[model samples]
Target: ALVYVVAGAGVLAGSGWWPTAALVAAAGGLALKAIWFDPWLSVGVLLDVGVIVAVACTWPASVY
Candidate 1:
């Protein structure tokens, strides 16, 4: 939830370390989810991975 907020702020601000923060947070959240919540095969888990990937791929172009 907090990761999503940071990611949203990063996208909106378009500068600073927010993008990297979002990327790291999202990845960490995904890892935590995998470890404690569900198997890697679950759709929710895969969605979390997708969010991490999306943040990573977009970070370079997004941050100023």
Candidate 2:
């Protein structure tokens, strides 16, 4: 869910630059919502999860 991304981002922000990824994820979710004709929330859901996974995997724990 999009809320998960926001909440996770908030927590991650407390740690470091991870908050930036969260902001990107949130923007991606919003963009999906705006660009999709049907506006299904699932599009944003996938984007948010993908962003979180991508950031988490690539960034080292110490960096965050």
Candidate 3:
């Protein structure tokens, strides 16, 4: 939740290490969800994947 929010903020501001942070957070969230929360698959998984994709795609090249 916190990671999602921070990533969102990072995407919006395009500052700091938000994009990378978002990617890491989204991956971690997906793993944790799969391992514990929604092991059977759910909308949460889809959302996590979406966040990861969006962050990766929109990540500024300058940041790298």
Candidate 4:
């Protein structure tokens, strides 16, 4: 369901690096979408962007 590529275990442990992992995963997702270029994935693109923005906005408290 929710993507946790780089932060699976970190997320489970509530680690501070989880946000960084999420940013990495979201960036990866956007790259994949660009490479594959599927109209069906438009909504996913928006979500990926959202993750990137949200993590960046909260960076101070997220990835310590």
Candidate 5:
């Protein structure tokens, strides 16, 4: 759901993806509002960003 998409965006962004990441994040929000019945919470965009930053900094550069 939203968490997944946000995480995916952050991961992708950390891997050098930009607009796609934004799209993913937006999509996550949209999915949360549209698909899921629980629309009271905002997607954890910051959490995903933090995850991306951490992974990017800790991991070595490699194409996988």
Candidate 6:
């Protein structure tokens, strides 16, 4: 959860490490949801996918 906060802040701040941090956080969140298997977590799955796609699309040629 803290990673998500850090990654989100990084993304907003245009930090060089945001893409990696975001992807890692998204993957970790998705894995956690999968292992827990709660119906309410479906939204989080979609959010994870959104984060992945967003990162892929927005990544720049040079982060810094």
The candidate that wins on lDDT is 6
Per-residue lDDT of 1-64 in model 5, one digit per residue for the tens?
5555654666665555543454555556555556664534444544445545645564434522
Worst 10 residues of 1 by lDDT: 55-64
Listed in order, each prediction's TM-score against the native is: 0.59, 0.38, 0.66, 0.75, 0.31, 0.81
- How many times do residue backbones clash in model 2? 0
Each prediction's Cα lDDT score? 0.69, 0.63, 0.75, 0.79, 0.52, 0.85
User: Sort by TM-score, best first: what order?
Assistant: 6, 4, 3, 1, 2, 5
The residue ranges of model 1 lying beyond 4 angstroms of the native Cα positions read 39-41, 59-64
Runs of candidate 4 exceeding 4 Å displacement: 1-9, 59-64
Local lDDT at 60 for model 5? 37
Q: Candidate 5 lDDT (Cα, whole model)? A: 0.52
Shift in Å, residue 57, candidate 4:
1.0
Candidate 1's residue-wise lDDT over 1-64, tens digit each?
6867876787787656675776677678777776787554477667767767766577456354
Model 3 misses residue 9 by how many Å?
A: 2.8
Candidate 4: count the clashes. 0
**Model 1 pairs in collision:** none
Local error of candidate 4 at 4, Å? 1.4
Off by over 4 Å in 6: 59-64
Q: After superposition, how far is residue 64 of candidate 4 from its true place, in Å?
A: 8.0
Better of 1 and 3 by TM-score: 3
Residue pairs with colliding backbones in model 4 are none
- Candidate 2's residue-wise lDDT over 1-64, tens digit each? 5655565766656755545656576666667676774646776667767766767585545545
The sequence of per-residue lDDT tens digits that candidate 3 reaches over residues 1-64 is 7887886687678677887777788799788886787556678788779877776676445644
Candidate 3 — worst ten consecutive residues by lDDT sum? 55-64
TM-score of 1: 0.59
